[model samples]
Target: MHEPDYGVAGRTAIVTGASQGIGKAIAETLAASGANVVICSRAQERVDPVAEAIDDECEGTALAVECNVREREQVDALVDATVAEFGGVDVLVNNAGGEFVAPFEDISPNGWNAIVDLNLNGTVHCTQVAGEVMRENGGGSIVNLSSVNGQHAAPGESHYGAAKAAIIRLTETLAVEWAPHGIRVNCVAPGLIQTPGVAETLGIDSEQMPEREEVDRRIGHGEEIADLVQFLVSPAASFVTGETVTAKGVPKPGNSMSEGLGLE
Candidate 1:
């Protein structure tokens, strides 16, 4: 008659791109579960309010840091700040990423590089930096944010799909390589979630999203994704690693190009 234990209370975690959207939801969810959370974004102004809000409402403490995950130095500083505040890192959520829709041929080299750097290189930087602390501390969990587009064909988002696909491969490899160190690595590929960015870019609002119960080709919510992330990083999933969990609603049998173009 015992319930599954999350084992996150009092642990320390860092969630990147936590200023808003999926990242913000993950941070708030973890903090509510009693994990001291450090939330970061590219600008101090962007993440400060989120940290303050988490502090006000959650059981755990929240720290705000300005970090561009593409920069190794910034990633180092973010990890250092986390360790200084909470002693060590027990979890990392690599959620900082961005992309724009354009045909493969229309994408400029600079544009392609920017998207790849942010989505793929940024994850590499954070994982390497925070992973060092996790290794030293005997073990930790890392959850990466990917998208459904990575698994399917993306007509207008070739760069983004490529980067995200790389993340999945990286997760699998790292999971195997780091298993001996007691570290666990996993990836979450979410489908069309109604984040603010999605609302802006795709004209899809949470109000328009179907209820969770009506699970046929519906948009998802950040909280639902957050809940999945929480479980993945918690003791409940102790035996799970090197896996990519897709949280998109049930797939339909047709062209999904339009859906992939606006994946958030």
Candidate 2:
């Protein structure tokens, strides 16, 4: 198999929700690949460390901004700062997102709104602001992070899944509308991957890591996800717009019960 190269060097990219998890990974990978990357989260302190780490490793410059993407004003300022720092934008990764694990019935208005404001609305605000700069620059790439729960709803993830699903639709719509402006918008929905959050949430460690990686599972690696993201933002995927690329591992054909072996 031929390995893909994500040609993002010298290009300016803004990654949101980049203080930790997949967002942080994406920022690091982009920086390593030679992109003039800027990242933001809810606070500058949290993102400063991330920026420092990237600066220590990346071939290009990294900037950290304090931004809460759920608000349009913050997103606007984020774009302006990025433009001032790097001149223009070439890639916009709308990766700042989270979910609340509550049953559909238990999802209060405020709780549901919080999840949507961050996941869906946050993405929208970033895309709008970033797209403006990218449109002015002729063309750019926008990679929206989604989830399998959006495709196959998992219990207690109602708000999260719905927001992600809307993102898919938004990707398609924006792809069509923005193609004329020379912008390519796409989505990447990842399967269960090993992250500190997952491990801590489930209270599992090395001993259970392998068990969770059984043949029938759709687990994946963070680096693998980063690789795909790198591809999407790179010139290699010039024709890959309006698509939702799933990065989950192969799911077995057997039923859940068939794959169940923890008791054994």
Candidate 3:
């Protein structure tokens, strides 16, 4: 096994959306670093391969559960399965989410509710349930995946942006509320990265190659994001809580577009 800052050896973790992309990477990394990990996505078959692959390579135990976090029953079972297998959860990564980009007027109630339920309500369910277990077993850490879009609104993702923004506030609130119980909550708000979902949304082609290249050349990677997450959950970050750690390439300029374009 690889040496990791997190003496994650034997620490049990539950990472949502762990079938692919950023969540997959986080699960794999955590397992490699010595944490017994429980990972879930909505698909059992799809996630089973990831769990098997992780178990083969990492020192920690891995389990893949098919859980649609939007459903409370499944989310409860996901947590229950983890506790049954690993004894308890030490880290919870709320990484399962989806987005629907459309003109605000064109967004149907279904579209809006789905995003709200998965991103915001899903986080709520997982954190609430997992916090209860962690509180009983002893306190733990929660790392939520928000987005930079939450901080900077864009053309067609009003719903996604709103949900992500709420995650930031929710992180802060959970930190305060759960602190007394010995749990720490933090959020990671990432800028553009070359993930499948992101690429698909951008109509990724030669025209978008420059943007993708720029992000690769400047922004973060799934592994790097996982590294930060490892730190935030480890004792190294005991002092850090209720903070929205932005993982953008540049320090946010803090200036409005109007100011930059001289429209002000």
Candidate 4:
């Protein structure tokens, strides 16, 4: 019997928002799988140390670039730098996004635009830019990061939910359009993953989280999401595209949105 192959060894990948949290875990996971990874964040100083750490600890190479995915020029530069350093792009993970707690009526126009820009427009910019590289290089895989709020009602995150929902639609459309180019597009909608950002926002610590073996696991870890991303981008999931894998643990009865957001 033969074991399944990840098919990521020696390939080149780009992971955005890699300075911390789930993005950082994805970058580390991919690099450890023998894929030369380009990790980028809006701040050079923040991402540089992560790149160094990955270089020292992982099996593959790591390149750090400062890029805000909302900027088209910056996204272009990021892809160019990746191609120059790693020769070509085989995988692109759009993981840069942000949102704040605000009810629909309380959300200002500026706030709405900001969340949508970062969460939706950012994904668009990165996907289009890196997707071109993939098109030219024969084929590649793209994994988009969304949120479970996209699929369900988000009481205090209306803008975020809207943007994330758009990403899911975008992924499905892009998958069909890019199929002829040998490019695959998919999305991951994570639910309550324990990351630095989540810790700070929700005041939930790792020690407070339930264990994986718990009968009612409510929260998840970044590494768990990273593993899913690795499989999606690797050949093991070659047939998986235009799909949004939601990693939220088994839902509990009568859990409110505010409770999930840690407002309870």
User: What TM-score fits each model?
Assistant: 0.91, 0.89, 0.89, 0.90
Once superposed on the true structure, which residue ranges of model 3 sit more than 4 Å away at CA?
A: 1-5, 205-219, 251-264
Clashing pairs in 1: none
lDDT (10s digit) by residue, model 3, range 1-264: 745355677898999998877898899999998899999999999899999999899998799999999999999999999988988889999999878669999999999999999999999999989999999987999999999898997779999999999999999999998898899999999876556666567666533544543342354567878888888999778899999998876432334543565644
lDDT of each: 0.91, 0.87, 0.86, 0.90
Candidate 1 C-alpha lDDT tens digits along 8-75: 88999999999989999999999999999999999999999998998899999999999999999999
What are the per-residue Cα lDDT tens digits for candidate 4 across 56-160?
998999999999988899999999999999899999999998788877999999999999999999999988899988998899999999999999997898999
Ten contiguous residues minimizing lDDT sum, candidate 3: 209-218
The TM-score obtained by model 2 is 0.89
How many clashing residue pairs are found in candidate 4?
0
> Candidate 2: which pairs clash?
none
Candidate 2 residue runs with Cα over 4 Å from true position = 1-5, 200-218, 252-264
- What shift in Å separates residue 87 of candidate 4 from its native position after superposition? 1.0
Q: 50 in model 1: Cα distance from truth in Å? A: 0.8
The parts of candidate 4 lying over 4 Å away from their true place are 203-216, 251-264
Worst 10 residues of 4 by lDDT: 208-217
